[model samples]
Target: MATETASREPRTKTRTTASPTVGAAVVKRTRTVAVRLTDAEEAAWIAAALVDGHRQLGAWVRERAVAGYLGKVRPKAGGGGLSPEDAAEVAALRQEMTKWGNNLNQVAKAINSGQVPPVMAEHLEKGWLNRCGQALARMADRLDALDDQG
Candidate 1:
């Protein structure tokens, strides 16, 4: 005898395939983090991000912060980049200082060895002591300026 089969309703079965179409790591790689925002300023911040195409906001803020910090710093004696003459003067001063340092070291060794005549030793000591005094005076002047600032 032939049996009559009922019409099957539309099946809602989900695919349970063993292999996924995409890798798990790639699927979950990018995550959006939510941050609390002030109602008033949120629009402005988002507008900035949109205007800049969401690129380099951190760098822009960092540059602005650095500029503000530099603005607060005290200006050097001549300020900004040095002029050619100023650089040349600094180079000359460095050479002079190096020569003085070598002279001072040799004199120190001579004095320490106790072989040089006492007269020569006294004169060298006197000259070096004067230079040291001048250097200390300049340091004191710088410190005084700091004190004045405070």
Candidate 2:
């Protein structure tokens, strides 16, 4: 024998999403991917995705998901029209991203472990995430604008 609970509610079917004016619309999904992760790899990816205040992950994942979507990457050696100032700025952005990644991881651990006290890590984490997101978006746009494919 089986038992069921009844609710006074109407059921509805889902409809499709609308397309954008300028570009084609994409359907959102909830499909799952299967991967075999060892302890080390799991830990590493978590660190990577959550690092630096959970800001860079979006950009990082986007870049990986769509090749060349962020536009031209740095020029190779012997590449011409490469300005030193631009190169230096890009390098600095990378460094900034790294710093943010580390800070994010620290904050995540604090929140997870319920330890690392004397520190309300969430506030700083949120601030850094906002800063990193702005910086990342700008840098990606700049890189795209340069069209610096080498």
Candidate 3:
């Protein structure tokens, strides 16, 4: 006597392999998620990444996603990769330098056009030039300090 056989489908298993560690933590990125974004959505993501001081869009996206999932708040990104306090100080120095440069230019123009005496122009140029140089020095120092800390 012969018996009847039942038909069965083959089953395949999905793999979740661990990837290499990124940064200071040993993160095993075992799964991949695919997302489809419209042009406007991609542009918005890029802008947000730039605003967050992130050079890598993927990293920024992952960070935002994880933060959102975990309900965490991150810092702002308005200082060209600098802290808020450092950025503010740098901005103030930049404004001061700009003002000094303008003053020096005006002094030079006055001297050239014979609107001011030679002695007065000399004094004004020297003062403004000194202020500009000081501001530049401060900016450099601040950047150097930031680099050191970073």
Candidate 4:
């Protein structure tokens, strides 16, 4: 009768332990940072956070802090010095400059190899100089436009 009762009793299952990698992945953020602000400063920060569509001031501040740090450490293309459109324009200008440089090199090679007459070389030099001046003026205008936007 005792053996029969023991057989009828339910067996307990043992719990399995989590792997180290899984346990590490489940760890929660426990670090804290504190900041002190005056009443007016706190109020201003709260308003700014609200304006930025953040429900919590802490979240807003954290996002901004991380963004600012990332901007300083790994800035966007054009080194965060120029807006996207301006950066693209600068890239295009660089490409154009490279083409101009190649063209100048070809002209120089032609002149040095006596493949071009003196008059034609002079004409090519003058044409490239004019083109360079025009490019410079256009770049200056674009810079002025960017300044105005800023």
Q: Best by lDDT, which number?
A: 3
Please report, in order, the local distance difference test score of every candidate based on alpha carbons: 0.46, 0.50, 0.62, 0.57
lDDT of 2: 0.50
Candidate 1: list runs displaced more than 4 Å.
1-80, 125-127, 132-150
lDDT (10s digit) by residue, model 4, range 1-150 = 111112343335422332113544643333345577764555556555544545366666767877788863222323234444554454455446677778767777887887997776677767866876688678768757864653
RMSD of each: 28.6, 14.4, 19.8, 23.8
Which ten-residue region of model 2 has the weakest summed lDDT? Answer: 49-58
lDDT of 1 by residue, 1-150 (tens): 223343345334433342224754322222222345563344444334323333243433434445588864323332333333433333344345556667767777877997777876777667856885576566556545533442
Query: What tens digits encode model 2's per-residue C-alpha lDDT throughout 61-150?
Result: 444445467564433335343354444444455566677778778877887898856545556645756776787788778766654542
Instruction: Tell me each candidate's TM-score.
Output: 0.33, 0.37, 0.37, 0.35
- For all candidates, what are the clash counts? 0, 3, 0, 0
lDDT, residue 22, model 1: 73
Clashing residue pairs for model 4: none
TM-score of candidate 2 versus the correct structure, residues matched by position: 0.37
Ranking by TM-score: 3, 2, 4, 1
Rank order (by lDDT, best first): 3, 4, 2, 1
TM-score of 3: 0.37
How many angstroms is residue 78 displaced in model 1 relative to the true structure, after the best TM-score fit? Answer: 15
